[model samples]
Target: MVLGAQTTEESGAIAVYHSDDLKSWEFTGVLEFDVTNAQPGLSPDLVPRGYMWECPNLISMLDHSDGRTYDVLVYCPQGLAQQDEHYVSSDQCGYIVGRLEGSTFHVTRGFTELDYGFEFYAPQLLSTGDDAITIGWMGLPAQDDNPTVDAEGWVHALTLPRRTTLHNGVLHQVPLFPLPDKPQTQGFGAVATATCEHDETLSLVDAATPRLSTWHAEGKLLIRRHLPTGDETRSVVCAPGEITAIADGCAVEVFSQSFALSVQIFEEWQNWTTETT
Candidate 1:
């Protein structure tokens, strides 16, 4: 079965196809869903609705906590609102845990953002043996203001390959491959065992510009990055969990059971620091 989305900001729909040879395909049905009714008891909701739904991937993942296999849909929807309280972002990468019945994809748990960073979209899943890994573009559409385009003549990068699984009913991703390295930069990787009871912040900081940081406040994980005029930030309300981070030059990736955040820091030196306050 193949599920494809209409990549437009005015409307959203996914086309279902049936393939027997894995090459030739035939149309089966369209899985058009209402966002308001997609989730039953999930928090930190995705845009009440989305206009542009791109790269709709459906995977069968085993719920590790329950030892049961279930279907998971990874969706990239553009055209969400800018900011609502501590949560921000319009181009969103999220997932829905559900089951497919003949022509219908029913929701077990509605859409939840997969990445909580500045740049991450259209993730594609690669199956390995009985497991799977996902990789996404570490950049966004119409966000081409990075200094590297002028300094090095190129821009953007792909995220580290991540291993995915389900715990309880929630999807979790962890870095599967080492961070990619580039010239003139240092390689940094470590498991940050944070006992963040109240608040904690991990950041790529510089004195001159707005910092790129991921922190936990209350029970939400937030990522803040720079924009043309000022800056923008987003959050996923989650409990603290195991976190692992990697850096090679301006590229940084953070991972945990709760969320994954990736960003490209346009700086000569990538200095990441963690603070609990």
Candidate 2:
């Protein structure tokens, strides 16, 4: 078995290891990137440079659509800045789609965000039957001001398993199964569904110390929160249609057919109700 790991020391690059048995392993070599000088008007997102990479996951899959097999490398790069129109989180999880040849990955397409959500990181890919699915942690690193830590003394949860596919050089995600129709009210979590008319709004409000709200506006889905720390909001572009939101304590993951967005809620609201119109 071969494993990929992030090295904090040395060059802070990704290290590859090989093992004949599950117990013993040997260090192979580091993944190398070719660097080049860019013109003054070029955007930095076209370049890949980071201080350290974390949560390196490498998988080889056969794309039956084109009858070609490719290697996908997913990793979180720490301290990388975002430029241009790329929506990258502070600690972003991205993937490199390429070909693996004898311990080296030849880059076909550059890195891109695996998810545009704020709380998506440390994603793991699993294969079952003939499909590849992914699960990501719905928490941000170095952020520890959530109300759940004080009220329940817990901080994080895994996202619902999502089926992932590569289409037109982008990764698309969808729920593995249909979302539950029953209303859920367990602990600080809730699941709500809404079907929108043309340009309508769907609202979810949680009453108490940390209140949360989500709605679709313009061409984007927006999430706003009122936490003890402060008020904040995050959004992503999506087509107007049916939407579903799954809230867990201070974090909520919103899903649409095209994309997904996850945000943290932190304020207390007096009106504890949800409405869709």
Candidate 3:
């Protein structure tokens, strides 16, 4: 799979190709820019006359559990920013979602499923049939201008891959291995183990679960009663791994392994907030 900028005569464009038998090949045509339609959704006077697309990548996510399939693409657009320059500065860098129809591929999804924070760029994804793995270049045009990055040589690092699942029509993500291995303890010991009264607010110290607000305790993990606010922010806390907040009807379940902990979110309250030792 290939992704790149629609190029023009004055600039270079990135392209991709694949062959099964090495002797025959089939692929998407190159994406080069042209002055006529080079800049999407831009005024003619403000368009960057000549620019090239950088890296392009693609991954396929074909899962039977959810019964939906799609491919992901990542690429960079290299050109002068809003202000044109003789030398290339940079342009938008992010991932795009697409679908494959036999030998024809179409990109229909844009990068809205990204963190709104000021971090992450040049993101990429690799689909393993069950999951579409993602990573990104921490460094970007903004980072290059920052003083901290100038001294560090490396201005950024890829975030841990997250597994995305659509639950009740809303998308949720969990760090592949969301929970930490530490056990919630009591007294002056490790972070997870703590004590709290029945009706009180406590700051979470364990990094194993999401920040939680609850009426009870379970070792180091937190258990919270999810309240409805018609807001996406209303969620359970399951630190290090997945953020577990009770939605219209969802809660977290915990289980134990040798040295690590595993957590699962469920709609059934019966096993939602269990404390298995």
Q: Which prediction has the highest TM-score against the true structure?
A: 1
Compared with the true structure, what per-residue lDDT tens digits does model 2 show for residues 1-277? 3333446652236777777885888887777643232121112343255666778787776555675666777887777765533435677777766666656667666776776666888889997533479999988788765556655577767887888776534466777666666767764368787764445646665544325556667776666665544666666566677777777655677777656776655444222223311
Between candidates 2 and 3, the one scoring higher on lDDT is 2
| lDDT measured at residue 70 in model 2 versus the true structure, 0 to 100 | 67
Error of 3 at 192 (Å): 12
Candidate order by TM-score, highest to lowest?
1, 2, 3
Measured on C-alpha atoms, candidate 3 has an lDDT of 0.38
C-alpha positional error of residue 42 in candidate 2 after TM-score superposition, expressed in Å = 16
- Top candidate on lDDT is 1
Give me the displacement of residue 150 in model 2, in angstroms.
3.1
- lDDT against the true structure, per candidate, is 0.66, 0.64, 0.38
TM-scores of the candidates in the order shown: 0.78, 0.74, 0.44
Give the poorly placed runs of model 1, Cα more than 4 Å off. 1-3, 7-9, 32-49, 82-87, 178-195, 200-210, 226-231, 240-242, 268-277
The residue pairs in collision within model 2 are 208-268, 209-267, 209-268, 210-267, 211-267, 226-267, 227-266, 227-267
* Residue-level lDDT for 265 in candidate 3: 24
lDDT by residue (112-224, candidate 3, tens digit) is 22332223456565655655655555445543433223333433445445565432212334555444355434321223323434343443322354233432333323333
> How many collisions between residues are there in candidate 3?
17
